[model samples]
Every structure is written in structure tokens, then in C-alpha cells.
Target: MTTICVDAMGGDERPEVVLEGIAAALAADPELEVLVAGDEGVVGPFAESHERARALVTTEVIGMGEHPAEAVRAKRDSSIVRGCAAVRAGEADGFFSAGSTGAIFTAATLGVGRIRGIRRPALATALPGLDGHRTIALDLGANADARPEMLVQFAHMGRAYAKVVLGVEDARVGLLSNGTEDAKGSELAVSYHEALAAAGCGFAGNAEGTDLLLGSFDVIVCDGFTGNVALKSMEGTAKYLVKQIKAAAGESKRSAVGALLFKPALKRVAAELSGDEYGGAVLLGLKAPVFIGHGATSATAVAKGTAACAAAVRGGLVDGIAQALADAS
Candidate 1:
């Protein structure tokens, strides 16, 4: 059975949405168990109603604006800290939070700890892909800068995630660059490109910004600053395009009729592009599974994130990445 510890006090909606999400997840999976960590005043009653969940009271709460590491250290009884401690102590298989991204990352790295050979943990997210496959991109704001060796490590980490969680055979890894040429981008990208090419891990050379949503590669690697910018750009662009499509469809009676006819197709496309279905970002290279959902995530998104964390734990994601690193060594 896979047991996950959740920081119930995290996120904008607090225990209400978290409890609703936990209820939904428990209803969906009979084998899953959850340890809800938060103030006993809130989480205790909710846990009592659920058969598969139990509450672990935490006295302190970490605010979003506080310094991540300092807040984690000072507020040892915070939900986020307690949840991570649960994983470290072997009381849970994974940890999930819709908390401060930096705080969650810091707690997971310092509390649950990193895998044996991981230099820095990378934040990876699944992008919509063709043929029902999701492309996994990494270093999404975990580290602002990355060395060539670190980029190589990110490739291996991403490839393992793609293979184990995404079920992609022979996952193609791409380095994000300005152009799909050998001699583009900064010295960092140039050196990283050469290193990835010689690393013999299905390197697909450089991928420009346009190739991100095209499903051109199974995994895309880049520095955190660049990757985060690209991610936000794609998100904003997707939203803009969706709005344009809706406006265009409603502009004319004929267009409205056509849209009604194609409503199902449009719904499918919207679902595919929706960030809620992606279940939040996974913090790879950690000793145990750690998922960081958006602060404004809905109950459905929280439920999906919980399920994703359980799947990663069941899939032996950490072991797969460890073995991949061992092989490369």
C-alpha cells in the first residue's frame, strides 16, 4: 500500500479544499492511505470521517512570503515540515503540498533528503504530448543556473521519469536553445549541448521555443531561469489562444452553431491544455516522491496531484533514477 503525507494547511484554500481533495482521492483508490498534517482544530475532524486517512497535528504555519529555509527551520511544527518529516521517518511513502514552492523544495531536500548521487533536485512538469504521451521537462526553477555536468544529470533524471512514470520507450532528451543549430545560445548551452550529445542518452540536439508544445522531444533540459520563463510563456500563450478561440466562436451565429457542433472536440482540447490535469510539478532526484502543486489549485487539481504522487511512489521513480545515474557513472 502507498501512504502519502499531505500538508493540509498549505495552499490558498487551506483545509477545505485539501480535505475535499483527500476525500476524492480516497474514494478513487482503496489501497491508498494518507497522513494529513495540519492544525488539529481543522484537520482532525476531517480525518475522522475518512477511513483511510489520519491526522497529525502541526502547531505552526509557514507563510508564503517568509524565507523558505529559515521558515522551515524556525517553524519546525509547520505542516510542510511535519509532512516531510513523515516521509523521512518512513511513516509515509511520499509527500504532497500546495505550499510555497521554495519552501517545499527546501524541506524535501533538507528534511526527506536528496537521492545518493543527485547534485541538485530538479522540478519537472508534464507537458501535453501526442498519442496520449506526456513530455516531461525539468529544471523548472529549482536552480537558476546549471553547469554542463548538472544539465547532463538533469537529462538522466528526466529520462528516468519519462520512462517510468510517462512510459516512454527510449525517451529522446533535448536541450532547449535559441535555434536548433549546433552553435546557438550562450556558452552554457553550447557546452551543455556537446556534453549531452556525447553522453549517449538519446540526445536530440537543440530544441527552440516553438518546439516546446509540439511534443518534439520526450524530455527537454535547460537552466531553471530559462525553463521557468518558457513554461510561463507557454501557459500565458495557451490561455490567450483559448480566449481568442472562444471570442471567435461567439462572434457570429453561424460560428456559434459550428462551435456547438464541435463542442466535444473543443472540450477535449481544453482538457488537454489545462494545467489542472497535469497534477502539479514533481520534484525529481529526491529520496522520496515530492509533489508541489500551485497555490491557487482547485480541489480536482489537488486530488490529481495526490494520485500522481502515489503513482510515482508505486512506480519506483527514485530507484529508476538512481540506477540510471549508476549506469552513467
Candidate 2:
């Protein structure tokens, strides 16, 4: 069984809701082993409720609201640090956290280290696009600003992730830009356009924000600042669409009844579009699989995130990414 270490104290909901989600996930998959790293006092009781919760999961509490770097260094009991340590020590295959992203990123870098030749890691989030496939945007807050070479490296990492995680073979990659023309974006885009093209990463030229969800490419590459904005925009748009649909249905009794009749189908569609369904973002360019769950992620999200991490580890995504980067270099 692949062991996944979860930082139980990281999210806003902490041990309670996160525990509830873990219960739900374990109930769904009995064979999965989870290590809940958080306050044992809080997590212990919660684990006793389920038959296999205690048997399958072990609790190791870490302090909350502490400086991640200092905490990781000083507090050997801290959850995030211990969780990463477990993975590094071969006790677990992956680490999932909904806590402090900065701390989690920092801990992963310091404790787990990056793959060979990977300068810095990038956060890759999947966004729903045209057809059935998702478009992945990299550097989604990993590096605030990236050099032209870094952006080029992100493109390679993004392409490999799409192929392994999303099962896309010839992943199309586009540089985020203001216009479709090659000269549309910043000097970075202009500088890296030929680099991406020269690297032969199935380059799809420049893509605009308007075309982001229109399925312009399988992967989109940009610095974290722009990528984070684009990701938040997509998430906000999805939420607004759902709210609008709910409002439209409640406007009339007839519509309400219609919605009730199609509630299950609508819910299924909504769940698929929900950001949590994709199980947060993966910090690519690392030596081991690392998933950054949303701070407000539901138990379903945690469960799904665990599954995603397991798949990534089993697929050797880390080594594959390292090899891709080496080939690009």
C-alpha cells in the first residue's frame, strides 16, 4: 500500500473537518494507508471512531501557526516537517498539505530537496478547458518572477506533467501572452518563444487569457504572478457560474422542480468542475511527489489529493520530469 502523509493541522478546518474528510476517504478506499500528522490529542479521538482509522493511520502532531522554517528546524514534532521527514526517510511515498503554502514549499525544498538540475520547483494546477482534457498552468505561485530560462524550463515540466498526470500524449504548450502574435507578451515571452520552439516541446505559440478556457493548449506556461491571477480568475469564474445556475433555478417553482429533477446530473457536473476535484496543485521539479491542497479543501479533496499523489509516485513523475529537464538542458 502506498503511504500518504497528510498535514492535518494545516487547513483552516484543522483536525475536525480534515479528519472527517479522511474518514470519508478511508471509507471509500479501505486499502489506502494514511498518516495524519497533527495534534495527537485532537486526532486520537477522531481516529478511534472508525474501525481502520487507527489501524491504517498513525498520528504525529505538529504545532500550528509557527514560522515554518524556524518551526521545521526547531520543532521536530511539527506536522509539516515531520510529514516531509517521513517521505524522505522512506516511511511515506508522498506528502499532502493544505496549510501554509509558503512553509510547505519551503519545507519541501529544504527537507526533501529538488530533482537533479531543477533550479526551482513550480506549482502546476489543472484548469478545465475545451473537450474533456484539462489545461495545466505552471509556476502558479512558485516563483514570483522567472527568468526566460526558468519559463522555458517550466514549459518542459508542464508538458511532462500533462502527459503523466492527465494522460495527454502530445501535450500542446503555449506561452501566456497579451496577444496571439509572437510579439504580444513581455520581453520574456519574446525571448523564450524561440527557446520553447527550439526545444521542440510541441510548442503552440502564444495564447491569451480569453482563450485560456477555450482549450488553446494542453499546458500553459507563465511566471507565478500571471499564472496565479489566471488560476484565481478561472476558479472565481467557476464559482460564479454555479451560483448563477443555482439562482436561475430558484427564480421560479417550475425551474426549481426542473433543477430538482436534474439535481444529480448537475451535481456530478459541478463536482467535476470544482477545483478540489483535481486535488490541488502539484509542486513539480521536486525529487519526490508533493501535492499542495487548498487551505479550505474538503475531505473529498484530501481523499482525491491522496489518490493523485499516489498515481504520480507510481508513475515516476519526479524522475520523468528530471529526465525531461536534462534533455531540455
Alpha carbon lDDT of residue 76, candidate 1?
89
Model 2 TM: 0.87
Per-model TM-score, in order, reads: 0.93, 0.87
Clashes of 1: 0
**Where does model 1 exceed 4 Å of error?**
246-268
Could you give candidate 1's per-residue lDDT for residues 193-302 as a string of tens digits?
Answer: 99999897789889988777775799999999998999988878877887888899999999999988988987777666665687789999999999998888678878
Root-mean-square deviation of Cα positions for candidate 1 versus the true structure, in angstroms: 1.9
- Which lDDT values do the candidates have, in the order given? 0.88, 0.78
Pairs with steric clashes in candidate 1: none
